[model samples]
Target: MEKKKLITDDGIRYDGRKLDELRPIKFQIGTLKNADGSAYVEWGRTKILVGVFGPRESHPKHLALADRCYIRARYHMAPFSVEERKSPAPSRREIELSKVMREALEPAIFAEFFPRTTIDIFAEVLQADGSTRCAAISAASLALTDAGVPMRDLVSSMAVAKVEGKLVLDVIDQEDKQGDSDMPMAIMPSKNVITLIQMDGLLTHEEFIQSVELAKKGCMEVYAKQKEALEEHFKKTMDREEV
Candidate 1:
């Protein structure tokens, strides 16, 4: 079967977003009472829930850090998250994404403040679309902050890709499957420091640079939403306390 084109000749994407435009995003913090901190995020069709625990003891003794806390992240997709039900077991892709998420977030955390401990991050994908890893990282960062973990800054992430020979921001699943390139990035927006950059498919040097710049812009927008979600949650809590 012939695949449908991802972008129209008039420059509209499959979902009607323009090149460089992002799909609608929404976030909620402290959604799980049992968790030390938790957040839920919806980025386009992707939905992720994250829970943060610790600054507590690390298991197996040997994994304990002498100078800093260990950050352990796990990324899992629910069986029904995709069009086809995926196996519940952890896949290689999930393991790699978990490692990438931990590394991306490590730069922002002040792990030294909690030596001999570990900060555990659990991210579960409730719905699957393109950019699930980036969305999970963004949500996990907010969960960490809500848990009262010290941090240098919040991390925000976004994916940029080349579709129909044009650079685009926040590609969806169809675009990811059919597009020429995909680049996912995470950054400390306050410091303008990039912490993660992973690419799939191909891009020229110029296109690579352009995609990074575009991804940064998208991350800033995501950062704004992250701040708004946290602030909104706090405001509601304060209102409830006063009543």
Candidate 2:
């Protein structure tokens, strides 16, 4: 089968976005009543739900750290999340992404504040589009904040890809699968600290720098959306209590 063209002659992506444009992003906080905190995010066609549990005692006893909270993250996809059903059991990609998600959020968290405890972040992909890990990271960050975890700043993420010999931001599934380079990145926007950067394909030195800048721009926008969601949720919560 032939691959569809990702970019058009007029510099528009197949999804009708400019090279540096991002997909429409939507976020909601406090989506789960049972969890300590939760958030849901919809980025383009991707959907994710994240639940953050505990600065509580570590289970199994031995997993507890001496000076800081152990951060555990699980990134999972529903069997029906994709067009084709995925295995219910954890896949190697899911395990790797779980580790990656934990690392990305750890840098922003003040784990020592809740010493010997555990903070577990669970990200569930309800639907997979492109850049599912990036979406999950963004939602997990919001979920952590929703759980009242102390953090230096929120982690926002996005992917940049070299498609058809040109760089584009917020790649879709096709672009990611067929592009020359696909880089997913996360940053603590307030600190301007990069928390995660991973590439699946090749890029020249110049392209890497350009992609970083593009990804930064995308993350900043995502950060704004996150802040808006948090503020709105809190405002509504306060209003309900006043009643």
Per-residue lDDT over 55-139 for candidate 1, one digit per residue giving the tens place of the 0 to 100 score = 8899977899999998999999999999999999999999999999999999999999999998999999999999999999999
- In model 1, which regions exceed 4 Å deviation? 237-243
TM-score of model 2 vs. true structure: 0.97
Per-residue lDDT of candidate 2, residues 40-110 (tens digit): 99999999999999998999789999999999999999999998999979999999999999999999999
- Our tally of clashes for model 1 stands at 0
Clashes of each: 0, 0
Ten-residue segment with the worst summed lDDT in candidate 1?
234-243
**RMSD in order of candidates:** 2.3, 2.3
